[model samples]
Target: MDIFTLTIIVSIVIYIFIGNYAGRSVKQIDDYFVAGRQAPTLLIVGTLVASVMSSTVFLAESAFTYDGQMGPFVLFPQMGTVGYIYGALFFGRYLRRSRTTTVAAFFGERFNSHRVQQAAGLSIIVALGGYLLVVTQGAAILLSDLTALTYTQSLLIAWLSYTAFTLYSGSKGVLLTDTLMFLLFMVATLLFTFYLVSDLGGISAAIQGLSQLEHKADIASWHGVIGAGTEFPTAMDYLIWAIIIDISWGIVFAVSPWQSSRHLMAKNEHVVLRASIYACIAAGVLQVLIYGIGGFINLANPDITPSESAIIWAAKNMVPEFLGALLLAGIMAAALSSASTFLSLVGFSASNDIVRPSSPKKTLNLRATRWIMLAIGLLVLGASLFLPPSIFWLTYFVGTVFASSWGPVAFMCIWSKTITASGAFWGMISGFFLNVIPTALQYLELIDLPSYMDPILIGAACSLVVTVLVSRCGHVSRQEKVYRMRLHRTPAGERDLKQTKISVIAPAILALYGCVMAYLMVTFYVTPYQTASGQLLPNGQVDWATGEAFLSVSWALLYIPLALLTYILIWRSYSPGAKNIEQAQTKA
Candidate 1:
């Protein structure tokens, strides 16, 4: 076998070993489901970043940027990171307080309804099952290309590798293995990106080169290669699509089963908040590096076909052999990390939420959960063999299902006194079906929906309307009211003044990093457009008639610093000092 193929095989073997080793700690369902709720900040952050970044970012998202859509594509992560703060403040803490094994259980317990839990669990199975299929195909695709194996053979290998460890080790194995994968991919991506940028004569010259490319004019502009020939015909069309999708993704970050569930594994409410703050920073930095270099790769080799293959192509042809092998392995790491997380949740929900409510026996529940996980893995493997991969769009479609279906209901469950079990159950059901059915019909060409009428918008609006209406027709019981109040009350372990002060430093650092990014964009991106004055584009190669788009895009980055500063203020209110005052007022 080639060095690249050998490297990938070795990595998977190591992960399997590590996962089984960690499995030795599993003594109960909690250990299997949430790492006994004792995970520290690093493991939580690792899994959070690993689970979300997947091959979708490495391949699908990179393809968008490679095709000169970097301007708008970057906004998705920008908004998504903002959702992390939302989770820290409004959603994740209460989830840990509920002390549920899965996000589905949180819903069930919060409402005191088994049916609601089953409904939430079913949504996770269907949605995350689809997501699992997408990421599995991603890993197989990577392996097939890097090695001599056919797609089917690679699919089987990838499936068994993640499944074996996931079944035996459960969350303990997955968490430890995910952290290892996270560190591997992160270091590999940074190294490859640094080399590529230097090769293109640094960021300044690369931007200038991108502006003058004959076939890809406006590549560096805010709208990014827009025209009649592109997927987005007009600037307005592109901006609207970007904004809508970005907002959906923001909701995904806040409440998606995979992302929010990581908080359930954290050691305490403080770990949830601190890990989320750091995870947001890590994801933002990595995406900017990954997506930022996507368009720049075109400067190195413009003929890369099937833009999804852009990253793989660069690894083989643009970098040294060792670095290339490591990068390819990193991409596989992304796919495996996500696939394992999705598959585990599928098993967890199927057994814990769907089956456990009926079984009621501990041994039967454990046996059913493992078997269900195995069955789901096999099912996904079969699907991978036949399903045509559309990695980026498929990932987006399935992920947004959670945003529409769960986002509104998740937040309301915590903050709204009027919401009832009926509202949540129906809201999840409607939101999921409304989003899925319309998008399916549109794709089948049975109906033509306008570009502005994205199904995500329709489904989310439907969900919100139905939830409010259904909630109005019902009443919150005393039990539900007390539960809500308890969630709001501060946990004794979380009321630490010293830890709060320490946690503040992370956001403070991120706020400063945001300042640095804003400065760099101004110096590298906006300044060039301003001085373009026709010299940078000597042959009228420049696409824009003015610099408005450039200036607006550059200045918009300031929102990051502004948002982080605001978050720091909110985080401080969690200090014991603030909690004591609130408690005194309540007593009064």
Candidate 2:
């Protein structure tokens, strides 16, 4: 066998071994669902970053960067950095304090309704189904490109590797394996980036080459706008849509089940808080380097198609054989980490929220969870194998669903007390349908909508509006209101609630960052620099050299420092002394 196959096999074997070993520690439902709530800061950080990055970072985002330009690539990580900070401030401590095994369970408990919990679970299953399918398909495409295996065969192998480990180790196995894989993936990504830059004769040469392209202004600018009749019909549409997408994605990143689950599993609330900082640092650094490689590759060879396997194409053609294999392994690791986490989450929701809520025996619940995980793994695998590749659109659809359906209700539950159970439930239902139905109709060619009307924005707005209006119309029972008031308080008093530094500062920081990003984007729109016409007389154009300088200086002076400040604030505010009220209730 070639070194590539041998290396991949060895990595898969190690994953399975670690998973099986971790499985031996599973003694009850809790152990399987939340890793006994004992995960440390590093493990939580690693798993969260690994799961969030997924194959999208290596496959889909790379392709988008190559096809569209560096504008979105630079914007992507900035959104995540803000999202992590938002999550740390708004959800991290509260989720840990809630002590629920899943976000669905938290909804159930907070609202005092099993139906809401089940609804949330079903939504998660649907959204994650699309997400897992995309990741699995990306991995399969990479493998198929490298070897003689067909797509189906490659998919089956990917399925078996993740399913076996998930069935054996559950969340513990997923966490441990994810940490190890994250280290490997990061190192491999950095090495790949280095090789790509060197092959292009260093960063300066790469930037110079990009500047000489016909669409150099668009490629280098944050708004990706070019001459009067460029890709976007109007420059404002591009700018507005770009900002909306970034903000929507950031909100989803903050509150998604995959991320909240990590918070639930941490050793303590402090770990959860601190891990967000680490995750932001890891995600920010890696995204800039890896996506930079993608943009550079497109500049070097515009002939390369921006397919789902674009990064793999870069790996095979730009790097040495051994390095290429290692890079492939890293991509595999990215897929496996995300697939395992999502699979385990589906399993946990199925058993704990849907099934075990009937109060089944611990042994029966544990056994059922494992079986459920296997079933979900197989189901998603089958779907991926049969489905046409739609990684980019599917990712957008799923992200919108999760963000629109869950974001408003989740924020209300954690921060407010006025929302009734009925309001939350109906809000989710309305948001989900409103968001999905329009997109589905559009996809089926039954409806034609204007390009500017983003379903995600409309749905999220409707969800928030419905939640507020319905909540005011409905009233919570006195007992439920009392329960909510109690939930809001802590042993350290209301000061503990008020002491969240992130909550106080993040909004201001987010606004400032958004303003700065908008300014940079506006500069792109007005700038008249175009290699197509080579027109220096327009005065509206900013030359490629000037654009590149602005981008470098803004990224250095504005984006990086803001990200670092957010991290430092989160670290400084982490309080180990804060107590978990829900854990106290459990012990009692």
TM-score, one value per model: 0.94, 0.85
Top lDDT model: 1
Where in model 1 is the C-alpha error above 4 Å?
A: 74-77, 356-365, 529-573, 580-588
lDDT of 1 by residue, 1-588 (tens): 888998999999999999988888887888999999999999999999999989999998998898887654443337677677677667987898899899999998899888899999999999999999999999888888888899989989999889989998898888998999999999999999888888878877777777777667776667787878786888878877777887898789888999999989998877887788788788888888888778888888877888888999999988888898998898899899999999999999988887544445544345667898999888888888887988887787899999889988999998887899999999989999999989888778898776688889989999999999999999988888778777777777777878777777766766666666656665665555545424344563433444433433442464455457645554555676664432343234
* lDDT of candidate 2 over 110-228, digit per residue (tens): 88888889888988888887788888887787777777899889998988888888898888899999998899899999888888878887765565565556644556455553446
Clashing pairs in 2: 528-540, 528-541, 529-541
Residue 411's lDDT within candidate 2 is 81
Q: lDDT of candidate 2 vs native? A: 0.73
Least accurate 10 contiguous residues by lDDT in model 1: 547-556
Report residue 102 deviation for candidate 2 (angstroms).
Answer: 1.0
Alpha carbon lDDT of each predicted model? 0.82, 0.73
Candidate 1: RMSD to truth: 3.1
